[model samples]
Target: MPAYTPPLADFTFLVKDWLKIDALYQSLGLEEFDAELALEVIEQGGKFATDVVAPLNREGDEQGCKLSNGQVVTPDGFAAAYQSYVDNGWNAMLGDIEYGGQGLPYSMAVPVHEMLNSANLSWRLTTMLTESAVLAVTKHASDELKAQYLEKLVSGQWTGTMNLTEPQAGSDLSLLSTKAEPNDDGSYKITGSKIFITAGDHDWTENIVHMVLARLPDAPAGVKGISLFLVPKFLLNDNGNPGERNALAPSALEKKMGIKASPTCVMNFDGAKGWLVGEPHCGLACMFTMMNDARFQVGLEGLGASEASFQGALTYARERLQSRAPQGVQQPDDKADAIVYQPDIARMLLTQKALTEGNRALAMLYAKYMDIAHNSSDEAHDNAEAILQFLTPICKAFMTDTGLESTSLGIQIFGGHGYIREWGMEQLMRDVRIAMLYEGTNGIQSLDLIGRKLTRDRGDMLGITRNAFAELVAGMASGEAQQHASALLDEWYQTSLQVKAFSAVDAAGGACDYLAYSGYCLLGVLWYSMADCAAQGDNPVLAAGKQKTCDFYIQRLLPRTAAHKAALLESADTLLAVEGSEFDYL
Candidate 1:
């Protein structure tokens, strides 16, 4: 196995050159953040990820987590690593300053998070969940709730988990059967058993806060009756420290194919004392505040896995001796020749590089808008919010799908060795598999993209995307990037019209393909812009690599859009031709 090297140079290129962090700061009227400070954060974050987190990944996977006597014990060294993370103020980076946080923009956290995920994704889950939980609390929680919980969570002395799934509910919250009754002291008694809760119980923190969803006694039926609650593992004392144990315990740990280090627990709440975080009968809206953030973070997770697998594959390709290249022996001094010289090996590596870099660019693009939506003035806010809504599902589904493809290619490049455990490529594939299933499965994301964001809004959100792409194309110098951008804009316009004509059944049938179409088009635009940026810069090698990757995306990957488009335009008659009962004929 190879070491996990942080993509520091690529992060620098994306933040400083591609995304133009300095100008973005100036435009948003943020005087505090400049390119210098951003680079510094990336540098220090890279060091921590490489030094502290990466070393624990393989061991954590091997040791996994053990449930002994009702308490979950994380793998050896996991506790020390987490303590170091908290002591170093890493968890406080993106938290609100009002609650002992540093108040940094989400854009600043993007690269740092990528490094962490690449270094150790299983270990990174707890940290990621805590940050998302903080966002939900900051946005919806009352002052009293914030004062009691925000400081501890932000400082990483406590961790947080989202409790939305029950054995019966899964993604359909309307089926939830949890009960919450009003208490005498202005709290609620929550009695529900939540399953598949990530980081539900961990020993790294002094306490755990659960953002739960349950139904009130007087609430209406279905999802409309759901309400969000804050259920703490230990009740806070008068002095603001953990006092008594709440009526909650992990009944069993879920055995899984990957991310075994991150405990997925079955939490039984026997009248657990809880408090509502948002208005009554509006739990879904409040939980979405956290879910949206989690969705984007899951996209980042995909990007990280893609990078890690690519690096591993690239390392192997450069050293593993195999048959000679078709043309001739590229390395005559070796026993045969490095596989990196072979055309097929080169192609796989190039595809991985293109997808990984393009996905990083796309994620930063989303993060930029996230900062704008949160901090900008009225007009900017509306536009940014629209873009965020439009991109959320695409980012989650497309990135992970393509990311899975990239990692699988990594395995293919390694041949039989890739399937072996010590090579580590297989583990990367296993871990990344969960991203597509969780945080609203990729299929669910596609439905949200087409049904809610596109057709429901009558293409208003897509029009926002079109205008941005047009403006991007118009400003570029006449070249391949210019041509690619114009072509994508034209295809997107035609495709949107076809999408508008989709019937309900047809839209559902083609949602995944339509999402892929949109994601490919979006990446085309991003790659062109990135290529243009590199061409005008001083680094010739980097510039050449960027241009070649852009070309590869155009020739090899962009063509995938046509097939997706065909699927999107096709009628759902054939899809419905087969009855649901036939699916289980085997």
Candidate 2:
């Protein structure tokens, strides 16, 4: 296969032309964010992905994480590469400046993350989990706690892990049984086991900081009683050096199907000494602060893997010889034409391209939301925050779902080569599968969209998306950009209205239940809005690709909304009344 290009031109078109991220940065009052810097960052990220990380992906997956004398050793080049990442200050891309970070907008960090993940997801997982820890501390940890531990985490000197899942509680925090008892001075002694902890215990860093969830001795039942604790593998003394060893240890490493390079450990917190990150009984809410950021990051991971796979598959499709062109039969003199010459093959390739391009645009749009939500000085900040809250689950669930599907298509595009591990296409597939499962599973994401985000806000979220789309359309109605953006907006508006009607009906199920099946409609509106945003760009091939993908999504992808409409309004009976066991007969 040919060396991978980062699709910089496409990225440029999306950020500079289509999304007009400059406008967003200006809205956020971020003076440092601009076209030149963005291009430089993305170009550097691409180089890092293709050169340093991509080479190690296969090696990491094959070597996996080795268990030795209770120490989890990562693959070769991984620890050095992680240090390189920290030296480059990549982990603190959007972290707090007070903690020695760059404090870039999440928008700026979003695509940078995509490029990094695309280059090599396994290696990037460590950096990503580290950022999540930074978020947790930045939001909830105290000045004293931050002063003691924040610098190392932000600098990536010490890695971090979220200890939420136990043997019984995967997604349900209510089922958690971890315990914390008060110490004389205010610290707590934590005891319990956490399962599926990513980067839990590794030799990569001198110390590991675990953001653990546990119940106090006198705590009430369920989530409200839960508290967040900063439990490090090795305690930090006043001088910030590794002190007495903490009791937290990896009882065992999991054998997951993918991203084998990053260790997933079942942690044993044996009366481990820990400090509360935020106030007790308020941990879950504070943790929500990090969850949204982590969810969006997961979406980018899926997008990156899909893109890398597509790039590999596209190269293979264009060069590999296959059948002759249909019937003028112009390739009669040659042995055969490349597979790219086939219409069906072209359709599949175009589909992957369409989703990849659209997915990137959508990711940046969500990041743009993040930039404004955090940095904006205007009153519009609240509105932007609402929009981000509303759309985040969609971004996390929808983009990743499309990303996984696109990668599967990328594999199919490679046909035989896609299935073989030697071609490296299968590794991308294995790596991306986890995106749908982690940072909140897609099913839970759907429930969040319909149950919490859409209805609980009393259509505030609906209003935000509707108003934004209206303004985007209204901007082009009299502007010079109308020629390119007008029709797209009109179609999007009509669809949005249809979605409202589709959601408004109190079907046999509740409103939340209605949208569980109809969340895809909400996504249709979002995807089309992004497609419209992409339509405004200048570079013709890139713009044409955007326009084509936008149109194809509407024509090909949006029609699923019709079925959703049917399912939401008229078919509720068929849905719930269906025989549960008959449908699942053994």
Candidate 3:
């Protein structure tokens, strides 16, 4: 296994120096959170992730999950690790205070989650899904439902899963066939199968709460008929304990390419006892609450994988000697200098660093906005919510895309060794590939960004983000950093106009390119903000490194926006001109 170390320094820089989360907490009246408390949580969370959780990562991957007679068994050490995670109260870190939780701000939870993901992504999936489920239930479920399930889930005594994907219905929930018939006791009998259900069946928790999407008999067709139901693995007894088994079981575990330890189960719900969560036919809206949260978490998965890959590649490059440096040998006594001296190797490493760091900054900023959106009472709340809506898809798609690239670059850095299992770089690459596919694919995210967010709102969200970026640019010193920000803002404004115009013609054809363009521009803004923060800080070395990374992103990576913009602006006819049957000639 690759030695995993949480990037505490980076977290400190982001939360403390760059974003100054203390001010955010004060503004939002999050009295329990301060810089000291936040750092302490991060430090302790890092230890748990590194000591207990990370050790299970390689073991889980090698052993995977086992199924026997409908019962799914996790790999050795996993159950124990999960117990430890629960014992430490990590699961309840961000839960509601009314429900036996610490009620920490989401911004404080961001670093902790990043560390957990970095340590063991497969293990982290269970926790991530459960957290999302908790949010959905809290937001939409009735008081009675909350009284029954919230406390246990918040306490980590029970786990949760979101069941949205059926074999026939992946992204298109409108075609779902799950059936929910009204029962005499005012409950519902849910009978259907859901595929790719992460943590669907695990031995770690006594009861698994499945937030399922199904249809009523008398309901309207398509998505309008769908309803959200809370179906547990064990039906609650009169005393509210898990009594009789619900008519739900894991039919099979997916033999996937990566994250083997995380059980991707095909769940069969046969007349399972369940209760409606939100209103009938409004399940899609309720489910979006969960999906949106999961999307941001998935984006962090990409950031986490990239950080892990970078760590592995950086360690290997510094130790593996190859040829002399172009200038001179830094280590003259050795047979050859380390590969870190090579320009191309440096390029790959720096690119990974730039993307990972910039993504981290953006993710943290997004989390801060989430805190404001959820907790703040000021006039900024509306703007914060809008920005969060706008950035969620970009964060989900762009971060994961860069994660895949960074992990692949790790393989390149390791050459032959990276291809093999011993180095552990290959696992990072394989595991991160799914982040783009699940929780709404990157293509789906692109369409959401262009068709719904940008076009439907007449660039209102984009205008909000642009104004914010403009303010940031205006505050900066008049130099290269300010100039880069100005140029990016100009390009962003012009491209938004072009995409809005072009999307009117063919929304689907230009959506992906437009999203890519917006993603790069957003990252550029983040990089400049980081540079600006560093320049004002007292730490000279850290400031210098941040400046260099910012310059690299501006010079090398940000220019990719041009290609995406051009593609977005091109007439859809270029793509539509190629008929479906013409490819048969190949």
Clashes of each: 0, 0, 0
Estimate candidate 1's alpha-carbon lDDT, on a 0 to 1 scale.
0.90
- TM-score of every prediction relative to native: 0.98, 0.91, 0.98
- Cα lDDT tens digits, model 1, 1-586, are 4588988778888888877889999888889999889888989999999999988988888889988888999998888999999999999998888889997777888999988988888999999999989989999999999999999899999999999999999889899999999999999999989999999998898899999999999989999999999999999999989999999999999999999899999999999999999999999999999999899999988999999999999999999999898989888887799999999999999999999999999898888888898788787898889989889998888888988988899999999999998888888888899999899999999999889988778687888877766776776775766886888878887787779778889999999999899988888888888888888888898999999999999899889999999888998899989886787886
User: Which residue runs does candidate 2 get wrong by more than 4 Å?
Assistant: 1-3, 330-333, 477-538, 570-586
Question: Candidate 3: which stretches are off by over 4 Å?
Answer: 477-480
Give lDDT tens digits, candidate 2, residues 449-470.
6556654556777678657655
Model 3: per-residue Cα lDDT over 288-324, one tens digit each: 9999999999999999999999999999999999989
lDDT of each: 0.90, 0.76, 0.90
RMSD of candidate 3 to the truth, in angstroms, is: 1.3
| Model 2 clash number | 0
The worst-scoring run of ten residues by lDDT in candidate 3 lies at 497-506
List the pairs of residues colliding in candidate 1. Answer: none
